[model samples]
Target: MPNEPTASLSPRRLTTLGHSCVLLELAAADGSVRRLILDPGNLTAPLTATVAVDAVLITHPHPDHVDPSQLAALAAGRELPIFGGAGLGSYLSEAGIDAVTELEPGEHEIAGIQVRVGSAPHEVIHPALPLPANLTYEIGGVFAPGDAFARPEGQTEVLLAPTGAPWMKLLETISYVAEVAPQRMVPVHDGGLGPAHRTLHTTVMKKFAPEGTEVSVLAPGQSLEF
Candidate 1:
């Protein structure tokens, strides 16, 4: 059960880059740090330029979640793999991206990190709209369900809940958080929220989150260690 999440986890930093993108830096006992970028999209493109990343993770292939040109440029010759679900690998390949590693519902090692992909279908964006394959990323002491409300197996210390999206409401977010019941709930997918609205989300989520769960809101360019 070494890979299974524990009630308490070691220290790690989660840096919010607006929207779904974040820079996760995991520290090992030897003082070595591994950095990974999750959901590097249009909203976070500017910030990612200067940061060092060992790998890129895509939750889905939406333009907001995955920018082909940006990803192509980022992975130019670093030989870093873009870890994602089967669909993402195909999407990246068709987009002419190299070093694509498609994953399924299971645990795998990437860049010396234990990454897990959950088996869950994405929430309905719209009946008229097509839902591409979405990958849930469980790594670096945090669980990111891409664009879905699905939870990962075992316990997780932190959950990167999607708090802002046109496809969901406040109630759904609260319920999903309650269901997962993680020790910490950090709002992601919030690029669309303005100052007041962003504040509102933090306030409301804090109000209704499970008793043991704490809501931490990290705005663009903000970093929090947990």
Candidate 2:
């Protein structure tokens, strides 16, 4: 089957902010944009991207993905709905956020976009500790994995995947792409890693994908629109 037209897709653009952060800018068909922050690391092109985030989505309450100060700044200025698991919602409240929503692994509609929170765990966090519930989201057929194996499912036109710490194994990563069936996949989650670690990630993604999947590995400040 042919791909869905852009008009069918909610007016949304995915920008890779730093680390596991992704700026999801969703606009109404009329052109009003709703901004959502997924993970709170230093985002790429902050001056341009940060201005648009109206809602913030934090996958986990970790230091890298959840910055209390940033959330405070947004809450003080605007009424932003912060979405995450139950624990993360509590963490945001203590930080003074008024609008917060707790999401489990299921399906829902937000801002006219279909959001599916899939089951994922921090595979590499630790051996014995109870890893927080990790999430992978599907918005307008684009998969934005918080920090887990992003196996893009059927008809996924774009994929914003991770390539740094909290990443899946190399072979697993390849399998993820194979499953997603997206037209384009961009690598993210390198903002906090060192030069060598970043290099290794790039090399692995370049070598591991099946023949058909196209990987657009971007730097911090770059943008990819599907």
Candidate 3:
């Protein structure tokens, strides 16, 4: 066999945050870069320290997924747009954030980019009180399924997914990626947690990844181009 030609079908670049934080940069035919931060949990330190973002696509409002106070830092100094499910609007308003826009499973355009919100399941354990309206966001060939994982029907070049311990079951994560069928899949929501929750990092990749899925386990403070 000729190595299966993996390079031709893989993502161009990828950066992993210690605990499931990922920043994916996609190259547009027009030569501009479309950057997306999925589930920006506890990203305040990282963003302030080194990284600049153009836009943020939030899938849900879990503390690990959407760190309001920290995310606000990115919105500061520059006018960055934050897009999330309807629930995000309320949270943004309460946080006194002016640049946040909430989407309700529809198509939206921003900064010359097209974003589509797909459906996802919230925490099966606590489906009500913190009832999150999870979203599967597709923007410029990148798909991010915050914490939920009901695969959207479409073709995606890269997938930023939750492979951490708290958010999903190992098998469920594997099944989601299998269904979506992306050219490349990167794991998130991993070590962002504390010592008591480290096992999630191991289990996700060990148990969930499908046979053919390409998985990248990124270290904190690292970045990639795709």
Candidate 4:
């Protein structure tokens, strides 16, 4: 069977704003643009001052994934709808933030962009420690899986694959990209790596990623069009 249109008519642009935080500017059929931010934690000055974000999506409530101070500053007194896992709402509320929409694993439309939410239990750090819920967002064909290894329910063209984290292993990360089989893979969740480690990780990813898959690592302020 021929492939169906993935999501919107216009092309989508994915920008890495440092770490797992990404800014996606999606084009509408009407020639307009809509911006959605995924995991706006540890946002850099370039992302904050330049990008005009329409909405925010959180994959989890981890400070690295949803830094309260950065989130507050990003809101800029505007009532932006923050979408995330069911627990994020309460977590944000406790932090004096109220503009959140809890999401389950399903489809919905927010800020004029089509969204499908998926989830998995966060990777175990310790056997006794309880795992927090992690969300995977499929916005158009751009898949951002937060910190979890859960795959999206539909086709993914551009995948924001996690590269470096406490819960991630090099072999497992490679296997994830192979399983998803996206046309383009951008490395994320790599804020903790230094320059040397970053280079080593990138080399391994390029060498081991599925054949014909394009794995590109975006710098803090870099953007990739898909």
- What TM-score, computed on C-alpha atoms, does each candidate reach? 0.87, 0.81, 0.77, 0.90
The reply for model 4, stretches above 4 Å from the true place, is 1-10, 43-49
| Best-performing candidate as measured by lDDT | 4
2 against 3, candidate with superior TM-score: 2
Residue-pair clashes per prediction, in order, are: 0, 2, 8, 0
- Top-TM-score structure, candidate number: 4
Residue range 59-176, candidate 1, lDDT tens digits? 8888778777667555655666787766776777787676777778787877777888775677887889888788888897699998999887878789999878878998999999
- Winner on lDDT (1 vs 2): 1
Show the colliding residue pairs in model 3: 13-225, 13-226, 14-224, 18-220, 19-191, 19-192, 20-188, 20-189
- Candidate 4 similarity to native, TM-score: 0.90
Tens-digit lDDT string for candidate 4 (1-226): 0112246533777778788888888875575678888887753332342455778899888877887777766677777788888789888898898988888888888788888888888887778977678888888788888877878776688888888888889789899999988888999888888889988998999998887799988887677777
Clashing pairs in 4: none
Candidate 4 to native Cα RMSD, angstroms = 5.6
lDDT of each: 0.78, 0.67, 0.64, 0.80
Clashes of 2: 2
Name the runs in model 1 displaced over 4 angstroms.
1-11, 28-31
Q: Please, what are the lDDT tens digits per residue for candidate 3 over residues 11-55?
A: 334556555456655555575655566667764244542445667
